[model samples]
Target: MTVNPLATPLSLPARPELTGGRPLGVLLLHGFSGSPASMKPWAHALAERGYAVEVPLLPGHGTRWQDLNKVAWTDWYAEADGALDRLRASTEAVVVGALSMGGSVALRLAEERGSDVAGLVLVNPFVSSTRTELKALPVLKRVVPSLKGVVNDIKKPGQDEVGYPRLPLRGLAAVLEMWQSVVPDLPKVTQPLLYFRSSVDHVIDPSSSPTVLGAVSSRDVEERILADSFHVATLDNDAPRIFEESAEFVARVTAS
Candidate 1:
């Protein structure tokens, strides 16, 4: 349960060099079983561009996976949603940036908050799983608390995700439920979208991109393929592109 320094939350205020026309804030969310460490660098990049940024350490994460096993997906969403609310208080508009399971939380926020959410930047996002075994998770989790983790799927050497070493089954089942809820409201996500997908990702499957691109009602949607990266594209070889382009997206969307 020893906390890694990178796992801590990050909060930065808007600076004089702000990118957009108005005060804009961004809330970045990390994936399941993962810590804020995965998104810290990305948060700093946005903060440097003069955007208010918040990277919350989602509940039941950044600690032992056993704690993750005790919480549901709702807990994660609550943390993300609260962060968005807090950011909105000081900014004219907000953008949600997410990786993996964090994407689900972002989509739900957009679906519910509508115009308040200025845009979205998703990297290797996941909303559903084709893995057949998940159907039994509701029952299986009663017996098993966790499995080995699926973290640090980066092609870049020396990259570390700092995620929990185990996969929490209770949380996994709850996230699947969140996916179910988000998918149905995809049409409500009308904000501009910047979607980044890793062509060689090992954690995310092929279905997520199509599901989001096909269902979202957003008129401004851009899909970028990370051909050289894996699941954790934020820390992968193409990470600079993700950071740079996302800042650009934030600027374009927040500009009035």
Candidate 2:
């Protein structure tokens, strides 16, 4: 579980900023094996509109995938939880936005924080997988360190997510373990939610979106289907819609 300090150079740093204008803040989280880079553009989009934004680089991510193997789900969730605390300290209210596994963390935050979290915006979230192969992770991780890469599922040619090229089995198991614990508590996420699902996602299964939508207690839930993006829609063709619509959603939900 100890990380090599030399691996830090492989990933980018966390993004944090304070806009003196509004009391509203936005917390953005990246996906598993991914860094804050995935959420950077979205954070910028929100920041340009004068909202404070904090996009944290999760533990063991943004570096070598091997680093992720050293940390568990609690470590990752703790990073997001800490970010929420920091955001809440400086702003009147906070909204959370995430992509992929980040969405799972955001859901957990909303569930635990209650009225402290103003709203949620998620893109291509992953909760559980019906894939039989993944079920073997409980044992496979003991022998295999990693499998193939799951990053850069973008349709945009030549574009890359800069995430780990290899998927750490231990890390993947930690995420799935978190999913198992979070799924049943989905009903506690009563905050206003905006969920984006990609029609042709190769990474996440089709059932994830419906499972979340069906379980969450949020009466103010909206689902948007992305016709032209993959798992990393934030950096894909439909990115503009994601950015613009999320900004609008934040305004709508946080309006006075």
Candidate 3:
């Protein structure tokens, strides 16, 4: 059988739309080494429910992994922050949802934006890693260019996340930097939080969720365990739960 070209490791189109009904906007972020394809289903689910949604392709992402190494953590965060700004400008309130490293970026946005962000929905956010290799990232990033990839961690078959097949060391370093930067400010995220974690994940260490739950100052924080999914849970079996619960969370938080 012939393969679809878009299914290959190539840059995909960015997904962004403004649903003209609700004054509430949702900014959905995909994971590191991933494109908007991962978040597209969730974005559409929220949009159909009358919420404005923006799923931007992060800088240096959705393209070649080599390109990801050329950029820094700040670049990725800046892109997400800009998207949040545009969403906030059009809507009265904004809720940020992210997967993996995308969740780290969301927390950073919540910390910096303060009360501007209405709520947060995170799926297996990467905060810190216990990997011994990570300790050498600073030096390895300068010597090594890339390593084994950590993409397409979904358990569902015939599904594609359109992520890079190789992990760029510089990009990995940037992700580590983002984690370190966001960890300290976790307490600053006072917005309501909805965290979704897969029961079994090979990509991210399981310690991430507990660290977030313990650090965040949000009193309305809630956690849902994805019994049948992996790290990229957005494209897995429990996706509907994430989409529905996030929409409901946004409604409850943004209600005036």
Top model by TM-score, which number? 1
lDDT of 1 by residue, 1-256 (tens): 6666878888999874555346789999999888788898898898889999999998888777888877777788888889998999988889999999999999999998888799999998988777788888999899988888898999999998899888889888888888878999999989999999999978878799989999999999999999999999898899999999999999888887
Q: How many backbone clashes does candidate 1 have?
A: 0
Q: RMSD of model 1, in Å?
A: 1.4
Candidate 2 local Cα displacement, residue 206, angstroms: 1.0
TM-score, per-candidate, Cα-based: 0.96, 0.92, 0.91
Candidate 3: residue 253 Cα off by (Å)? 0.7
Worst 10 residues of 3 by lDDT: 7-16
lDDT of 3 by residue, 1-256 (tens): 2222443222122223333335678898888888888888888888777777888778877668888898888898898888888887777788899999999999999999998899999999998877786888899889999998988898989778888999999988898888878999899999999999999999988889888999999999999999999999999989998889888898899887
Given candidate 2, what's the lDDT at residue 126?
A: 85
Error in Å for residue 31 of model 3: 0.6
| Model 3: number of backbone collisions | 0
TM-score of 3: 0.91
Which digits, one per residue and each the tens of the lDDT, describe model 2 over residues 181-211?
Answer: 8999999999999999999999988888888
CA lDDT scores, all candidates in order = 0.89, 0.84, 0.84
Better of 1 and 2 by TM-score: 1
Q: Superposing all C-alpha atoms, what RMSD in Å does each candidate have to the true structure? A: 1.4, 3.7, 4.3
